[model samples]
Target: MEFFSQSLAEALSMILSMDQKLYAIIWLSLYVSFFATLFAAILGVPAGFGLAVASFKGKRAVITLVNTLLALPTVVIGLFAYAFLSRSGSLGFLGWLYTPKAIIIGQVILILPWVISLTLTAVSRIDLRYRRTALTLGATAFFASLAVLREARFGILAAVIAAFGRAIAEIGIAMMLGGNIKGFTRTMTTAMALEHNKGEFVLAVALGLVLLLVSLGMNILLQLAQGRYGERV
Candidate 1:
């Protein structure tokens, strides 16, 4: 009991004193998560929107595949990325292994299914009338789709927030792809794991606190988005 209390106190002190290394880990975590979410959103949003509005064969199969990928383990993604980025692997010439870029790639693959699946659900929930009304008013197909997208904006935002949360909290990809390099690719989750393994509780506890706070913030944003959408409805 006494040990835990002392460790907690030291962790709080480190956080309050704004330790550079601690902040560096937090920053790298956010940076990688932000870019991964960005790329995933850019690609997933269009694909999801198409799935919601378009009529095509095998659509159910594609959606089922995406849903299945949403449950893919972080370690599996890390290993998959490692296979392509390792020195003897096919795309290894770019030398991205054990770097921030490598971590970002792994994280992107980890959360892409979340973005796409959530986006499809969001767009699917919108009434068909939204699109029909826009098209009936002589709007072009592109503009009509935009109208529906505008209506589903809040739900899509929630999806993005959720994806960022997933990317930030994952440890496997960062550890395997980034190699947990201090002051470089090290992230909050990876740093916490390393610190814990080294029998250092202060830094690990501090990073855990920061990770919880980030998660809380994401949940708050999601609730706000859902609330705003509810108000409109």
Candidate 2:
């Protein structure tokens, strides 16, 4: 009990002091996760829309592959990325290994399937009549898709928020590919792991608190957005 109390006090102090290194780690985590989610959304949203609306051979197979990738281990992604980014690898000329960019790349891969799968689910759940109505109105294919998306916007936003949450909380890819460098690649999860391994409980606990707060804030925002727009869909 005494040890717990002491550690809590120390953690509070660290958070109150606004440690510069800790802020850097937090900022990097947010930046990388944002870009990763953004990239995933760009590709995933269109792919998901096509999957929901278009007919083609092997579409089921494609969806099955995406579902399988949704469960892919982050460490596997890290290893795959490392192989391509390492000095002797084919794409080594890019020199991204052990960098924040490398971490973002890995995270994007990890979350892309989630975004696609969830977006597809959202689009699929929309009423088929909605699409037909738009088509009957002489809407172009692009406009029809846009109308469908707007109707299902809340669910699609939820999918994106979920992907962002997953990317930000992930540690395996960040640690393995980013090398957990103090000022550069270190994220909240990675920093917590490093600090705990070094027997530095305060920073770890403080970071954990910050991570919790971030997650809570995201959830609140998601709920608010859903409440405001969910019924319109």
Candidate 3:
């Protein structure tokens, strides 16, 4: 108990004092996660929107595949990325292994399915009237789809928030791809693991607190957005 208390106090102090290493780790984690989320959003949103609106052969199979990918383990993604990025791998000429780019690649793979699946669900739930109404009013097919998307904005936002949470919290991709290089690729999760392994608890504890706060903040935002969406509906 005494050891725990002492470690907690030090951890709090490290956070309050604005420790540079701690901040650096936090920044890298957010940096990697933000880009991963952004890239995933850019591709996933359109793919999901199209999946929801378009009718075609094999559509159900495609959605089933995407849904299956949602449960893909992070380490699997890391290993998959590692193969292509490694020295002897096909794309090894790029020398991206053990870098932020590598981690971002793995993280994007981790969250893309989440964004796509959730966004598809959100858009699928929208009333058919929205698209029909827009089209009847002479809106182009593209514009009509946009109109429907606007109505499902809140759900999409929730999907994005959830993807960001997943990206920031994952450890396997960060550790395997980034190699936990300090001041470069070391992220919150990787740093925490390293600190704990070294029998140092202060930084790890501090990162845990920050991670919890980030997750809490995201959930609060999701709830608020959902509540507002309910009211709007």
Candidate 4:
């Protein structure tokens, strides 16, 4: 009890003092997660929209595969990414191994399926008649697609939030692909793990506390956005 209290007090001090190293870790975590989510959204949403709207052979198989991949473990992704990014691998020429970019790549792969599946759900729920209505009004197929996307915007936002949350909190990708390099690729989760391994209890606790706060704050913001969106709609 006494030890926990002491650790908590030190954590408060670290936060209040604006510990540069701590902030740097936090910033890198957010940076990688944000860009990863962005890239994933770009790739995933369109695929999802296509899955929702287009018809083709093996469509059910593809959808089932995507839904299954949504539950793929971060560690498995890390291993596969590492294998591909290593010097002997096909993508090795890009030389992304053990770097922030590597972690970003892993994160993008990790979240994309979930984004796609969620997006498919969102777009699928919209009545197909809307597309017919728009096309009947002389709108291009592109414009009709846009109408569906706009209506499904909130669901897409939710998907992004969920992806971002997962990316930020995940330790496996950061540790394995980023190599947890200090001041360069280290993230909150990796830092916490490193501190714990090194027996730096106070700093580990601090990082954990901050990670929790970050996750909580993001969720609160999401709820507020949903509220505002609801009112507007």
Candidate 5:
């Protein structure tokens, strides 16, 4: 109990002092995760929308694969990305290994499936009557798709929030791909692991607190969005 109390106090002091390295890690984490989520959203939203509106051969298989990917091991992703980014690999010319870009790439891969699957669910839940009515009113396919998307905007927001949350909390890809280098590729999760491994509980605890706060904020946003769109859903 005494040791734990001492550790907590130290953690609080470190956070209050505004440690530069800590702040750097936090910033890098946010930056990479933001871009990763953006990349995922860009690719996932359109793909999900297309999947929802179009029926074709192998659609079920694709969705199933995406669902399976949601649970993909981070280490596996790290290995796959590392292979391509490493020397002698196909993308080695880009030299992305052990960098923030590498972390972002891995995170984007991790979140893409979630975003696509969740957005697909959101789009699928939209009433077909809306699309039919839009068509009956002579709306073009593009406009009809837009109207359906607007109607399901809240659910899509939820999906995005979920993807962001997942990306922010992940450690394996960030550590393996980013190399957990201080003031560079280090993220909150990777920092926490490094600190803990070094028997430095203060920074680890502080980063953990930040991670918790981030998770809480995302959940709150999700709830508010759901509340606003409950009737529409």
Candidate 6:
């Protein structure tokens, strides 16, 4: 009990003192997750939007594929990434394995489905009247989509925030793709795992706190967005 209390105090000190190492790991975590979310949004949002609005064959199959990907385990994703990024693997000439870029790639792949699925749902729920009204005003289908997207912006933002939360807290992909290299690819989740394995609790506790705070903040935003939009997420 005494040791737990003392260690907790020490962990608080680590956070209060602005520990450079701790902050650096947090920054790296944020950097990787941020870019991962950006890439996912860039690709997923449009793909989702198109799927929601366009009349195309095989669309249901594509949506099912994206939904299925969301169920993939993080380690499975890490392994798949390794196969592509490993030196002996095809396209390995890019040398992305065990790097922050690799971590970003894995995280993007990990969360892309979440973003796409949610965004597609959001856009799909918008009343067709909006699209018809826009068309009646001589707006193109693409521009009409922009209006529907605007109307559903809150739900889409929530999806993005949710993706960021998932990416920031993931460990398996970061560990395998990033190698948890200190001062580089190391992120909060990976660092916490490493520290715990070494029987060092303070840094791990601190990182866990940060991860919790991030998750809390994201959930709060999501709730607010959902409440305002009155949409199911």
Which of 3 and 6 is ahead in TM-score? 3
**Residue-level lDDT tens digits of model 5 in 1-233:** 99888888887787789988778888898999999999999999999988988989999999999999999999999999998999888999998898999999999999999999988998999987899899999999889999999998998888899999999999999988999887788899988888888998888988888789889999999888778768777
lDDT (tens digit, per residue) of candidate 6 on 1-233: 98778777888899899999999998999999999999999999998888888878998999999999999899999999999999998969999998899999999999999999999988888876889899999999889888888998998998899999999988999999999999988999989999999999999988888889889999999899989878442
lDDT (Cα, tens digit) per residue for candidate 2, span 93-136: 99998899999999999999998998898888898688889899
Best by lDDT: 3
- Model 4 agreement with the true structure over 1-233: per-residue lDDT tens digits: 99889988998899889999989998999899999999999999999999999999999999999999988999999999999999998999998998889999999999999889988987887777899899999999999999988887877787788788888999999999999999999999999988888978877887888889989987977676556545535
- The count of backbone overlaps in candidate 6 is 0
- Looking at model 1, the pairs that clash are none
Alpha carbon deviation, residue 164, candidate 5 (Å):
0.5
lDDT of 2 at 47: 88
Q: Candidate 2 — which residues are off by over 4 angstroms? A: 225-230
* C-alpha local distance difference test of each model: 0.91, 0.90, 0.93, 0.89, 0.90, 0.91
Better of 2 and 3 by lDDT: 3
Q: Which stretches of candidate 6 lie above 4 Å from their native place?
A: 231-233
Per-model TM-score on C-alpha atoms: 0.97, 0.95, 0.97, 0.95, 0.96, 0.96
Residue 90 lDDT in model 2?
90
Tell me the tens digit of each residue's lDDT in model 3 across 1-233.
Answer: 99999999999999999999999999999999999999999999999998998899999999999999999999999999999999999989999999999999999999999999989988888987889888998999989988888999998998999999999999999999999999999999999999999999999999999999999999999888778766656
Q: Per-residue lDDT for 206 in model 4?
A: 79
Weakest lDDT window of 10 consecutive positions for candidate 2:
224-233
Q: Cα lDDT of model 5 overall? A: 0.90
User: What local lDDT score does residue 122 receive in model 1, on the 0 to 100 scale?
Assistant: 88
